[model samples]
Target chain A: MTLKIKKTDYIVITAILVWGLVGFWFNVQGAGAAEHKYATIYVQNEQVAELSLSEADSYEYSFDFGPENEHTALVEVEEGRIRMLPLEDDICPRHICSHTGWIEYTYEKIVCLPNQIMVVFNESSRGTTREDLDGVTY
Target chain B: MQPTTLKMRNRLNYLTYLAVLITFAVVIHTVEAALPLPMPVPGVRLGLANVITILALVLFGLRSGLLIAVVRSILGSLFIGGLFGFGFWLSITAGVTSCLVMGLVLVFQKRGLVSLVSVSVIGAAAHNLTQLGMASLIIANPDLLRGYYPLLLLLSIPTGLFTGITAHYLEDVTRRMIIKSGPGAGQ
Candidate 1:
């Protein structure tokens, strides 16, 4: 016997799939929503603003570009701060670094692919259980 | 002589078609590597060979389509295995699962036409999820899969549609010209 899948049945299935996708997308974003735990220590040329994590999972730290954007340092979580330059392109026009914003505590990504500047915020990815790299002199 | 002549020609033609399908799979695997997107994932490859697998199902049969998926995965990896790292296991599992899902539809369900568009769309859509599930098993990060699941589904929509359409067009032309024309046209 020929299986007759009605138009309505297929539509319902498609709708269910789309709804499932929408639900999953929101979950990832919400779960990924770090609490305001990441504090940015902005270092522009000679200027510096020390931002620290007052608590875990906190997110969003900001810095001023001073209308003369140059360079900055980023310390993800407990790792030592590393200086990074922003990627310049017509696409990434926002300049995530210069704008008043906050990012995660660790695995902090500074992707300037075209300019070859990629300072990632690899906070927890760095073996947290292992001794700090700074302390290991070997 | 008539029956034997037809049988030998048929076998050779089948082998030739399988060879051509493998070539297509290899080309797609290479493209997946060369065209690297800036997406956050460590390894993100399109299941383009799935087009061939779906085509095999629609044109030949479920078993043949399953064969295409298996052969392509093994041969494609042999050529471009470097980029995948440990993720090969994940892709293979998901690839097989998705193919089986569609192949089952073809084998068991008579009415649902195994169009290249439908089969690969279903196959490619599930490919990433199945692979991600495999990765989660290795990384011990089930929650990570849960987190990325939603975004992956969103991305699959347009990509799946495009790939499905391409597969559909290519298969229709090739089936019309090649498979449909071969000696076994009546049988």
Candidate 2:
């Protein structure tokens, strides 16, 4: 097989590699950094209830937050919205998107198993913007 | 061989193949579109129609497989009103790569089934990468992406295994049917 990769293909592969490098670099940078004033929306699985930042890590990552036991909702802050992203889809009957229903928070989430999705609000850093995370190309 | 013998050779039935591929694609798209998972990502999918891509790669060749993929994506988009905008490109890229690679493998190893499995796995991983890259660029959240790596790797392993096995079983049965029904089989 030729070692040469087309420009588009190269872009895809390199982009993935770069994504990892940048993420790694930032995680190291972000470790032990001060926590900001962002809210931590509570989600046990697919159901999302509001929680203080102090209670954020109280539940496990796989906790189900919704009435339906199908998929779990994981919270992540993105662009000032509590995006209720579904982490996995229920293999159960009537494949419902755990995200279905009302969401007041800008970044809300509803996760489904097998299809892991995490939606949360964009955590606003006190004195820093999303750009504070160095190596962040965007 | 005489010129008359050459002239009598039956040409491949391309129209029928195209029709079948398109219809199957439409049905798969309907299933994908009408149904939503418990969780929603703008572009993530099970890629169920890819099973057909594997089948085509093994039985026909790269060209037919590519044609089927393109037709499927285009028609699938029309039906769903193109909910997956960037996802369209990602799937097309993954489909093309998988079909071509699998076709080359079959040419060298004569293992169409195995090739299908590998190709599907590759497609799943590539599809994930495509979305991840876009997220990094557009969403401006590095931590959000870093958080996804473990899940992607974990999801890929089993999904790849299952999809490959399914494609393998389907290809084996379909191949037998094709052989038994083809013009020279009984004779």
Clashes of each: 19, 44
lDDT of 1 at A56: 38
The C-alpha stretches of model 1 lying farther than 4 A from their native spots are A1-13, A16-20, A25-138, B1-3, B38-44, B83-85, B107-116, B179-181, B184-187
| lDDT (Cα, tens digit) per residue for candidate 2, span B136-182 | 54566655566565455335444554666677788778767766755
Q: Candidates' TM-scores?
A: 0.58, 0.50
lDDT of 1 by residue, B63-101 (tens): 777777766666667777743556457656876888787
Interface RMSD of each: 7.5, 10.4
RMSD to the true structure for each prediction, in A, is 13.8, 17.3
Q: Residue B68 in model 1: shift from native, Å? A: 2.0
Score candidate 2 by DockQ.
Answer: 0.03
Residue A133 of candidate 2: its Cα lDDT?
40
Candidate 2 - CAPRI tier? incorrect
lDDT of 1: 0.57
Candidate 2 deviant stretches above 4 angstroms: A1-138, B1-10, B39-42, B101-116, B134-150, B184-187
